[model samples]
Target: MNPISIVLVRPRDPNNIGACARAMGNFGLSDLRVVDPYEPVWRESVSAVGVNDIMQQAKRCATLDEALQDTAFSMASTAIKNREIKQEIVPLPSLNERLQVAPEGRVALVFGNEKSGLSGEDIERCDVVLNIPTASKQPSINLAQAVILTCYELSRRPGFKAIRHPGQAPEAPTDAQKEIFISSADVLFEKSGFKTDFSSDQRKALLRHMLSRQGLSREQLFFLKKWADKLSSKLP
Candidate 1:
């Protein structure tokens, strides 16, 4: 497997940082880097549970540039798409595809703050932008959940190869991919004249559950994105 590092920038929540450490360890990824963290809570390892060792060994840096210094490729994770960045804002599955074929070089998955997410400057530092894709009404996901979802999606791809029961079917959409598809669908909802005041996160969560049950594939995801784009273009 290629070397992959998880980089957190100005992370404000201690529990979320710890949970990210645990999530990394869950998928056999231990290289963690924190940039300009205000509290340094991850150093104490209080929230990581059995993966405290991973947190203990994580590196700390004074800036995002410093944290990503050794990485050959970097991806910025954000909830909102920053129009200023010229880099492609790829969905989670597209990222997985690239990682699967990437050479053995340092790769960093950069995450931003819990509330405002990565700034435009932060996104510019990355080669690509990764959006988890949530509903239009409430397009935010929890920080820890974002880490878990990203790590879990990467783990499901060929490079990570997470172990599974012999007869059990694989998970569909993975959590990250499902979020992108649902978010794409939400773009269509806006075009359909649906009210944007509803609980979109809850609705997307339900859609994710239903899609998981149906076992969606890569081709299906492409089709959905295309359909949504066509629908969104028809709107005023």
Candidate 2:
């Protein structure tokens, strides 16, 4: 399997850290990286009670960039959207699709602080932003739960050929491919008369769910974009 790291940035609660460590261990992920945690409270004895081994192996870094230095790809989990940052904001399942293909790279899944999720600057450093689909009224999710869900999604194989060897890597979609698909899908939805009065949060949730279900490939994205363009030209 590919090496995966679960990164927590400036987490406030030791209990949440402990729970997150357990989740990573349960899902066969061994790497745990902490970036400037509020306190050095994640000792093996206290924080990771049941999963001491995982904690013992966890790495602590002074900064986010330091923790992510060795990673080939990184995804930031954020609840808010920042138009200034150019990184693609994708649904959770898109991460799953990428993992299904390139399961051998050094991939890092980063989560921000409990009170405030990733900032635009923090998110900009990542290759993609993963947003969990949730209701508009209650879109916020617990930190530990978010880590568990993301880990679970990346661990599952979506009909990809199993690679038993260490060096064998699957071919996952690139960031560009994912962005094109999302942009095309958005255009199609607009041309199809979908209402835009919905809050941006709600619209993002709907788009996340729809794109996740479809799992459009690169070729499919191109076709959809072309079709949407043709239809858009003929519309009154």
Top model by lDDT, which number? 1
Tens-place lDDT per residue, model 2, 96-186, is 7666555457988999888987777788888887788887777778999999898778667454332233673444445566556556656
What TM-score, over all chains together, does every model reach? 0.65, 0.62
Winning candidate number (TM-score): 1
List of clashing residue pairs for candidate 2:
101-170
Cα lDDT, all candidates: 0.80, 0.75
Candidate 1 minimal-lDDT segment of 10 residues: 163-172
Off by over 4 Å in 1: 81-83, 101-103, 159-236
The alpha-carbon lDDT assigned to residue 214 of candidate 2 equals 69
